[model samples]
Target: MTIDTSDGTPAASPDRPATPKTTPKKTLRPRNRKAQIITVAREQFGRSGYHNVSMEGIASAVGITAGALYRHFPNKQELLAQAMLDGSSSILAILDEVDRTDSKVVFTALVRYGLDNNFRSLLFDQEARNLTPERRTEARAGVREVTSRVAAALRHERPDLSVPDSVVLGWALTSIAFSPARHRTTLPRKRFEALLARLFDVVRTAPALPEEPAAQPQPTSNFSHTSRRESLMGAAITLFDQRGYRSVTMDDIGSAAGVPSSSIYTHFGSKAEVLQAILARGNETLRLGLVQALRNADSREDAIARVVHSYTNSVISPDSAIAILIEETANLPEEAQASTHIAQREYIDEWVHLLGNETADARATVLATISMINDLTRVRLESRQCAIEDLAVRILATQTV
Candidate 1:
């Protein structure tokens, strides 16, 4: 809605009105051409990915000649790079705000930003391939900013850890979170969150950092077991979520977990075990969240609210494990698959239980309703977030009622 003169210039922001010292009195008032080009490029890049969009295409969209565009940007790469940076400005803003917070906050912020901001994800996943070499490194530097933020948070949260300890663990957290945006578009939101919760539980832990003596036996009875399991699942989720089932090997999981290539067997019998654990924990986490949300529900409306809010919060929140579980369930062993199924069934049964015995006879109808609820919620998470409340209401009316 705001633009500077047709001459290329940055727009005025009340936040940074033209300052006497900052602006020169005679500079032709640096036009909004750069901003205008960025806006048009965003539309073009988003509609057709980087590969499909051309310099001429963007120039045409901006109502300028390709030669005129070169006046602002030396080449298409510079334009693409600038547009990518512009596209991710919101993410940078979020990262800026969270940079001062704890590791828990950083993990939460990264996941929240990735899921809620589709444009951010688009630019994030596309920039490496789309931007020029000079700018690609810059884009990666922004990505590493998240890693640094995570590391700093980890350092403060776990004071006993050394510098290396923080760096390595921060990498783990970033890997777990960074995968979904790069892939997992068709995945359910609740599922995504359960994985995050599971992953957060992972990044929030350390197996007694390398700074500690190898002979020292770390404390076991506290949150160690629970945290390690989630950590393993987090690593597994990243791998399975990124590389499909047939392609991911036990070695891949081990490498992802930062364990010795042969050490994965020390915990689980096979890669199947890894899959099972990730999917099982994912479903269990989701089931418990849904169960807890509906424990006091007395009306269909309340039931719907509790379910939608609970699942949506998890989906929207940084700790999304549910999406990871459902998306990767097929990768698990046969026995693990059963646990995953039971966990999912229990989530729906909890919803059904909230509806009471009256709907018991409507098992088929309830099943259909459950599917609708899941589908609508997932759709809300994936594409149209603005209308999530309306979507949830319609879902409740159709199914819970």
Candidate 2:
């Protein structure tokens, strides 16, 4: 028999078919979802390393399904490549408008762009290694083009500087302008922009890189034998610096160290453990050097100079730990990431303290100086220690506008 159901629909009987209720399907993706996805992807990739971020997380952040995101970007690599290329295009576009001869116009526009796109610097340096070789080349060409244009502009301003020096200075400016991405800063927008503008002048007037010093022989250590664990850590960082951490394998590390893959487990639990150990050692070295730099100072100015020089030396050294520290920290286990970050902050705080101003601008300046040194050193672009140190000191000594 037919009977009425709770909602007044007729219940199905042996001879009656049930009525199917129809509801309108809700649309989940936004009309501008493609651009939205790229924006959020850049933010997440910059905040966390590329391998550490997931397509699902990106989709969720964009308020869409994974399938929808895939429609826009097939994989995370494409998203990274797109994000970097987009940034490159944006910067290049800005340069296209400004008069290359007008230093103020060039600096003003660039600082504004840097503040707006702070994350691009981090993604450009630390995460681009994860891209496919073809995409990496494409992204690299974009970066080189930006560097070339900026160098050309700088050369117009300073007629005496060589192409190499102008490129190096261009990198310094880019690094300083984007330095806030390396660490968080609390300065308000206007103040930050002014600070960067002042730094632009600092870069403009800084002396040309002095001739590179001759390589001096290292003093012989009493202990000739290197520990297996130490050797393993050294090999791993070199590999990590060359290839992104995810691309490297435990077997690759072991082979580089001239040991079997099984031997690595005896020294370290996993590839992650090896990375953690390397970062930990790097942090310790930085702290000890900081303490010594402070302890040996004859005066306040002397202390600042000593610290700057020592840091420049360490950062530019062969297979420097600074690169891996910046790039691979996101790959460490969560607890390790927290501790390492705290230590890094403490290190920066010490520098800020030494600078004798606890203001946000001072902290930002110190961060910028450190980032500029690290960026230049990591790329192996220009290792002129005295020149870098001079520029660093000038950056630190700039008054807020």
lDDT of 2 by residue, 192-245 (tens): 888888888888877777767888998977774467787788889889987889
User: Any runs in candidate 1 off by more than 4 Å, and if so which?
Assistant: 1-228, 296-299, 316-319, 356-386
Q: Check candidate 2 and list the clashing pairs.
A: none
lDDT, residue 52, model 2: 79
The number of clashing residue pairs in model 1 is: 24
Model 1 worst lDDT window (10 residues): 378-387
Tens-digit per-residue lDDT, 231-297, candidate 1 = 6566776665445454578777767767776556768887777766666666666677777766867
Per-candidate TM-scores read 0.39, 0.86
Write down the lDDT of every candidate, Cα atoms only. Answer: 0.58, 0.80
Total clashing pairs for each candidate: 24, 0
